[model samples]
Target: MNAAPPLTPAQISFFHEEGYLIVPDVFAPADLEPLRQELHREIDRKARALKAEGRLENLHEELDFDRRLAAIYRDSKENGETIMRHLEGLRGGGFHAPEMFDVIASPKLLAKVGSLLGTGEIVASSVYRIRPKLPNIGRGVVPWHQDSGYFSTHCDKQLIITCWAPLVDATVENGCMQILPRTHRGEVAMHHTGGNAGFLVIKDENLPDDPRKAVTAACPRGGVVFMTNRTPHCSTPNYSDHIRWSMDLRYQSAEAPNNVGLWPESLDAAGKADDAFYEKGNVACYPPEADFLVQSRLHPEQVTNYAEYVRRRETYDRTQANFSAFRRWPESVATK
Candidate 1:
């Protein structure tokens, strides 16, 4: 792996000013190849298993990684969903592999992250997502909202950075993110439930800035688009012929409130954990997921390894914590 480079002073300045920064060379293109190949292999394994079980008609073996799931979906939504659920597009779903963990804990990626955050003691939120935006799919279309909209109100005042990296080149034609620049410094926009894909959305009138000023964020395979937690952004549909595969990871300063080192004494399939743990978990920005120390110069021994990360994630997956810290949005009442 190549050594991670730090962002220049000007680059950091632009990110703070514009609310989003697309750095196109944070990782060497080769650095992403391992994860991509592993994901493709995992898809093949899942598809074969489905076929053996008679859940799918075609394996879609001829198609490449970008088009395989789309082909499966074209044949059977059930089969596609099964494979997607295994790969996990949502938070705390499945898809835990060494390749995925390596990307998240990559020293190269962390250096750039540390530079933007202005701190070495970084807490990586388990809020990361594996997004596979398929061609012409309306379900992949994310509505306008800030990352903070999903977090507790107590965390809105803190700085949590989101790092979005595409597995393939993200283009406007392929549903790359659209960010509203210079609009992240204010209060979190009012978000409503029932946006496409069950995501929260900021209504036009509720947006912090005019939608016309939003910039199309096109990033390459090795690049990362860094945005603040309050940066208002949305994704468009993929009109292109391939999938727009990307991962959106989150990180924050260690001084900020987090649920690091917090685990349930016991958790069950019913989504229940220790009663006291529920209370303490509420201190995390997103209480449902487990946060871990990704980088800590103060205590390098405490950095979570792959085994521990997987255990923490899987353990947290079985838990559904009750949260009262974040303000809940009402269901969408719009007819249009």
Candidate 2:
């Protein structure tokens, strides 16, 4: 396969100015077929296990990837959630398959990221999420919130890019993202916990700009929607017939504060990491997940391999250790 090209100067400028960029052809539509198939197999595998255990009645094997989960969800919300938790992990490292990692570390995507970041050293975080927004289900409908709302306050000014790529042609009908352009240059707005599906949410009054000014981020399969940590964005409800499958991968410059090589010497299966490990991890922008050096032109030897990537994510997740004690925010957003 030919190497993916880097973003042009104009594209880079636009990203800096608008706070987000939607670039098409980041990958061929077929390039993501493996991942789609793998996820479908995982769903099938879990559903079959549930059926065998008499926990679930319908396996929904006749349906394809997009509709099968919806059928299971319609039958039992518990079963639907179980499958999601298994695929997305308890945190975010649950599914660290090679296919998922291949998308995360794709050279074509990184070339554009490197250009936007103006650096050769890049750090990939384990906070990457695999989202399968079920039709008419509010589980995947995100509210307006900047990515930084979930990070530590100390990382308010730092730059951690979010690369969101859909497995299908993301259209307005299927809950495409809505981004508040030029609003990212300011501070992270007030975010309330307990948004839809446990996501952090920034209320309309707290948003930097009027929510009416937000632009629809309709993108196609193989395209990528790049946004900064401070970019205010949200996804609408999926009103279409199929699932809106997508992944939001996070990356940062190596210069940013991260836990790339700061593993605890005594992190055990029981999650007893030494005090120093927790102390060191708190300084990271997002401390719970492991961060690894994905690309390092100056220190190529330090780049993490697939095995090591799996190791780091699994190791950190196994610990289940608490890291940063971010500032407390006001609780209780009115929900209907």
Clashes of 1: 0
- In the order shown, what is each candidate's alpha-carbon RMSD? 2.5, 2.3
Q: Write down the lDDT that model 2 would get.
A: 0.86
* Per-residue alpha-carbon lDDT of candidate 2 for residues 273-307, written as tens digits (9 for 90 to 100): 56776565435777667889999889999999999
Q: Tell me how candidate 1 scores on lDDT.
A: 0.86
Candidate 1 runs further than 4 Å off: 1-3, 89-93, 266-282, 321-324
Instruction: Extract clashing residue pairs from model 2.
Output: none
Question: Residue pairs in steric clash, candidate 1?
Answer: none
